[model samples]
Target: YLFSQRAAWKPALTLNGFLSASKRFVEKDLEVCVAGRTFMITGANSGIGKATAIAIAKRGGIVHMVCRNKDKAEEARADIVKETGNKEIYVHILDLSETKKVWEFAESFKRKYKSLNVLINNAGSIMSQRDVNTEGLEKSFATNVLGVYILTKSLIPLLEKSPDPRVITVSSGGMLVQKLRTGNLQSERGRYDGTMVFAQHKRQQVVMTEQLAKAHTNIHFSVMQPGWVDTPAVANAMPDFHRSMKDSLRTPEQGADTVVWLAISEAATTNPSGRFYQDRKMVSTHLPLAWTHSSALEEQKLMSLLEDLAKTFQPH
Candidate 1:
């Protein structure tokens, strides 16, 4: 089933094609009309998150830029304001690497915004060595997966208030080759493999979105791979590999286009919940045979773990 979807799907050409295909992609600069709608994008001070915030602001939307660094966020805010000429964008301090702070940030964010039209789970991490956070969880899992889970749960009520609520998680194509190892979820059992840990966490996101879509009918849930965007995250995470990858990589603005498209496009109205996307087109994320038939079972187990953790940590 998944393979057929992969076979039938073709990625949305280039942003260059979309740009040349219509004056609107140019006039609008590929930004969708988030005007009047509210968005909360994590890691919004840099990389693809910054671009996504700027894109939404360009279309006249209210953006809550969540970041860990206040000074960096202020710089990003200034750059965005200059680029978009839209002052609806604001910044919030959120170190998603910390679970307690994620919940607090969500509570404060909900109090300020009446409705949340979009939640872009754009923040992520890839550590060279296993680092445990204050919460005693693996840093990558805590920041990339658990943080997203808690933040989304806390904001679900706000999402319910919106006419068209969307949750777009930025996952990775690396998940295609990597399977989750339940025994080493925290990389505690053995030496840390940076890329593998990131892949596992991203796969966890896909599983979480799948469960969220199943439970929440009104809230649109989807995941997207930005296809090797030339961002600092990539540069810092894999300096050598990225040097070669950069030749084919998209700019941050180009990476931001599909995310903005998913948030506001008419196509989203009928799109299936929990679908995976690459570029602007929907794509299948099939588990490889090496993953064994137990892949589906593993996804279910991961969902159960996340739910249990959410209840234990955020038992409101």
Candidate 2:
């Protein structure tokens, strides 16, 4: 019932939330030009991903837009190019759920590019119905957890060598509702609930980021909650929630603000890695008194499992 209350969740995830947060934003943090720095954003065709790409491109950054559909990606690229006049934007197509292809894409990308200054793991999916890919992984698990784990792990070497390298994953506030359940990361259990599963996946991402940071000190790893935004994904995945919250929802740019800040702002990197952020401030991954904390052993299990799975599908 707490999750269903407007007084509980709405204030923190709505337009009013963004407006209040933006009042504290430092305008000059985004002033520096990034003519040579390269940034890659997954799911760049729309929503927070597209908005983040535009923010980077406008700063003269080399933007690599990764999307599942070529048509939508190219269309988005055209618009970004027109708006920013930064023609360095390029599009690459690869479905996140296809874990093998994601590995191939990263390997080839490493060979094609000299360096990737930052990687924004912005792609995510939440299905209304349960689905398992041919590889036997749940659809949202494949796309949200496994896909992100594989991509970030595969790209660490490249990122570690680059200047001011950072990885900003666009996670969500919904994850606070979930505890890390490593024994069933794929949701191959009893009754499957999409919301709970996605929340779990999002929670997995937070743990993954924290774990990755511990192992790699050269690169900064951050996971953030982009305030609830009016995006096609939201409408499609949760129509009822979208409809009721339409007026209160934030714009894509507003939702993407913290991501942009974290990517380029000096203030963000100064804070310790592995911490989660919302509205440009470092926030706790768990809500106070939520009883959602996972044991250290549970967190370790998540990393080991993901690492093992990643090795199996890595390009030899």
Go through the candidates in order and give the C-alpha RMSD of each one to the true structure.
Answer: 4.0, 1.5
Q: In model 1, what are the clashing residue pairs, if there are any?
A: none
lDDT of each: 0.80, 0.91
Q: For every model shown, what is its TM-score relative to the native structure?
A: 0.88, 0.97
Q: Which stretches of candidate 1 lie over 4 Å from their true place?
A: 1-32, 287-296
Instruction: Return the clash pairs for model 2, or none.
Output: none
TM accuracy, model 1:
0.88
Instruction: Give a tens-digit lDDT track for model 2, residues 107-215.
Output: 9998989899999999999988888887777889889999999989888889988999999999988898888998887777788889889889899999999999999
Model 1: per-residue lDDT, tens digit, 1-316?
Answer: 6665433332333334334333434334343566888888999998889988887888788998989899999999999999999988888887888887788788887897788899999999999998888878888998988899999988999999888899999998777756665656778877778998898888778878887898898999999877667889989999997886555666887777678777877675478998888766776665433342236777788877877776666636
Best by lDDT: 2
How much is 251 displaced in model 1, in angstroms?
0.9
